[model samples]
Target chain A: MSCNIAIAGVTGAVGQEFLRILEERDFPFSSVKMLASARSHGKKLTFKGREYTVEEMTDKSFDGVDIALFSAGGSRSREFADAVKKAGAVMVDNSSAFRMDPDTPLVVPEVNPEAIKDHKGIIANPNCSTIIALVPIWPLHNANPVKRMVVSTYQAASGAGQAAMDELALQSKDILAGREARCEAFPYQIAFNLFCHNSDLKPNGYNEEEMKMVNETRKIFSCPDIAITCTCVRVPVMRAHSESINLEFDSPITADEVRELLSTAPGVTVLDDRENNRFPMPIDADGKDDVYVGHIRQDESIPDNRGINLWVCGDQIRKGAALNAVQIAERLV
Target chain B: MSCNIAIAGVTGAVGQEFLRILEERDFPFSSVKMLASARSHGKKLTFKGREYTVEEMTDKSFDGVDIALFSAGGSRSREFADAVKKAGAVMVDNSSAFRMDPDTPLVVPEVNPEAIKDHKGIIANPNCSTIIALVPIWPLHNANPVKRMVVSTYQAASGAGQAAMDELALQSKDILAGREARCEAFPYQIAFNLFCHNSDLKPNGYNEEEMKMVNETRKIFSCPDIAITCTCVRVPVMRAHSESINLEFDSPITADEVRELLSTAPGVTVLDDRENNRFPMPIDADGKDDVYVGHIRQDESIPDNRGINLWVCGDQIRKGAALNAVQIAERLV
Candidate 1:
């Protein structure tokens, strides 16, 4: 059942997380090919207690690789998709290149494992924020059909990459010492401050990151008519992303019903403790595999009691990106 | 016309903001009195380049004051309400104690200046988050009334007081040095983390802070039928509070139309520039009197285009509290 694995872009943030997740999950891989750009060629990376040299990925790099996990940028994924498919390797892409392609199935294992069987040599991974949200939302949607959703995200630095995380720490140190913060990875100072999500704005005024949540949720849930609007903001946290979500269902639903359903749902941990005033927070989800859901309550503004609010947090590096891709790869084996 | 002014709770964060705002605006005052609790008695505070001694507030403290600006805690404001009223001084209280009182006018001067004229000696300042939100919303609502709103807040540490701001700075230093962040002013670490607003949770599962935005917005807008829901989270920012707001109006409204109405609105600065992706950030509103409104766009989910989204930021200490109260006081003069 073991197959050869090729990890492209092994030097970037999600690329590094891919290595950690693959080893942590003990995936049955016969061999792992560490592939990167020409700049990262000959660089060394350790995987599963073994040292491997990073090789530059090219048209011929996927000769015998059975499963090529790509966390490279969108352009790299698109450039190498044909090569991987020609070599008979299944490409599980963590990029926006093929997510909306009608032929390439977008998968979140917890929510849409069945979509993997329909993949035509290349399966696309959903966006980090979309995956984090749908992991908890899918179980509830199955019970009482969500009619509309309004979401606001408190995203962390990791979603931008390792460089952004490092910039946050450096900015914190510089700001604390009364020096000006250096802004390289982000357009604005991300230390003790936040701004709207830095993504290309669409003609409709929604950013690409926000639209991914809207479009990908419909693709993954197989429900295209559900109305959704999202406002995404990048906050100062370094690892995990949190969201404040308000949902209107087809019928009346209660907070207790949501808690009861998510209590045993896969990949969800209900951390709601109303009496102690404890709920989901980024610090609680830093290195966790499960998406923490809390602050579940009936939306008081909806007089019919058909609306619900949830506070959700999950590690953007783990559950949001790398682990999700690994989970999809696990199904192939 | 010049009138005597008394600033109660002169040692608190909002109290200090009151002094700065008054001086910056050149508020006409025949006499200034600095009053606080016994703990702050004899403390020296400088206003308009003159040092004044803090006096322990008592029933007689408001004897000759024409207007008393109260930023003390709710209980202290309640304790002195009668004393200030008995001495013929109009109380512009910044606590929640009297905001919903039948005879008190909860005012955001920019939104509801006429309400100030109806006050029975006590004109209450709305919550900081509410004041910041309504300043921009009021202009748009006047053009076409807002029927419903969904809001999520990114509040700063200054809302909790000066000690909380200091704690955020201290926590950032400790965490950067690889030490545990001290948790005294907040229930959890707030250096690079955020949590649900620390206010007591109501039976409806909304915290007091969220409900304040709901209730106070209704009172100030004088539209009890306007449905609202809010999720408030405290971030690590030092001064300003940011909000992501979605509004559904009575009929169709475009982003450009809303922006045109807000361009000349008093106490509001439109900072939206989508091409450069420069929207309002907390740092942009820090220590500023105007609430910065940006990210103005039509909510794509609503097909008929009755929905609009806004990103807003305002100094929680200035426009949210002290300056708002001072503006009300100016109206009286």
Candidate 2:
């Protein structure tokens, strides 16, 4: 099948990843359009060794576009998503704008690929941390129904954008050189320091980032009855995100069984080498497509082996956002 | 009473911290002896504007010492602890070698100062991460017992040693300057990356650092019935450690009550400002003696209010190690 694609917000971090992934995967496309804001209009973006000038996104930018991948902020997606759909194009949005909407399917292709068929012109991509987490969690839950899941995220600055990544580098240099750290991209220093996720705290006392994990996981897994809680924190890492997850099952399970199951699971890699002290580090997951899982062990606190713990790392830009949306687009054809 | 003190492993990271804390707190001592390995013997160290030479620790080094604070490795403590007691000095050892010994009292002054009276001759300081966690956990457990606890740590390089801290600095510079990070102090690059704690893994699949948090908290709190599990990871931060803790209680508790309880608690500070996103960060806790606790909220995943979540940060060198040992020594006098 021939395809024409448009990448909205093509100059942002995740947008850049969107272009690179398409080129590297040799995605077949009859035409490609790079769309960005007016500030980035006319900016040259090189994809597949060919230069394409970024067009200013507007109501009509999706003309003749078969699929529109949206990674701009939530407001932009909310404003332009309908226009894309009105132009007879499917929109795979990477923003939180429509994720919780009952009509918009919140999809992690690996976890809920069938949900794609139910989408009414727009399929919502899960949050980066949520996408990285559920990719491994869904397989485990399918084997043994998880009664409860607790997640603690070690997120990276790239989740904010390319500007935050630049801030981290600049702050680290200034701090090392005995100067005050610049704090434009973040509220405080992001160099050699860690803080709680800087999202707005809801009335329930959970931050927006944490609640997104709780809400989006329930939607994608189609298991609102599953007990889930998450604590999200930002560490000083550049791109990849890490999570320490604890899962409680309705029935007993063993870590060895978990390793065996994930070994054959798509988009999963096991790196649990206890003797060598080698596990999934963020560096190992950066620039990689697969979610790295390790430190898988039985939670000894629970009786009858009814619980398991794991550490997972994934490239937030790849498996978390742009690549996930692209994977959804791949299924459309 | 005036006392003659000896600091074992004075050349190490925690040992040097011991001296700074002693002077800062104005610990009562008539004279102080600096003891270290033969390689560091005769090295000059200044304490309170007084110069002292580090003596090679031997069987006779504790002769004139009344209270000997040991921050050396486990083997060094085991090799010299008996000698310290034989010389009539009360030994406050900060190594795991004696922490679990039934004969030795494992103590966190804020949590279990009464345990100091049960010491045969040695008082063992709990692990750094354990000490930081139990400071705030004890008060809540006193109000209403904790049935289960799940702890995930964001530890710093200093937990490994001074050399590890140096390696983190050097590696960050190298990576930023477009060079491969040097990996002498750690098995992997610790710049812009994180991994499972480097401590040896036990047969049960828990790393030693994680087991230390579990075993030490059980001993210090004197609550063996509480189910505790921990996952410890090394972040790129330099000195302070952060933790995301989930606590399950026997009865329901409100976040407001927790804030009230911690406000009056000793050596604890509350920083939960939800409006401005000003919860505790590592930089805020660095060089501070208090355990900064915040992000207290109900775990909504539970059907009832039987769960509470918290974020805590504390200087691993100050309250976690050396100051904790000094506080134990203060109780002796």
* DockQ (Cα-based) for each candidate: 0.79, 0.83
In angstroms, the error of model 1 at B103 is 1.2
**Could you give candidate 2's per-residue lDDT for residues A220-318 as a string of tens digits?**
999988898889999999999999999999899999999998998889999999889899999999999999999998998888999899999999999
Q: Which residue pairs clash within candidate 2?
A: none
lDDT of 1 by residue, A1-333 (tens): 999999998999889999988988899999999999999999988999999999999999999999999998999999999999999999999999999999999999998899999989999999989999999999989999998899999999999999999999999999989999999999999998999999999887778898999999999999998999999999999999999999989889999999999999999999999898999899999989999999998887877889999999999989898899999999999
Proportion of native contacts kept per candidate: 0.67, 0.68
lDDT by residue (tens digit), candidate 2, B1-333: 879999999999999999989999999999899999999988999999989999999999999889999988999999997898899999999888998888999998888899999887899988889988989989999999998999999999999899999998888888889999979888998989999999999998899999998888888888877798899999999999999999998899989999899999899999999989889999999999999999998998776798899999999999989999999999998
Task: Give the range of the ten consecutive residues with the poorest summed lDDT in model 2 chain B.
Answer: B217-226
Q: In model 1, what lDDT does residue A198 have?
A: 94
- Displacement of residue B293 (Cα, Å) in model 2 is 0.4
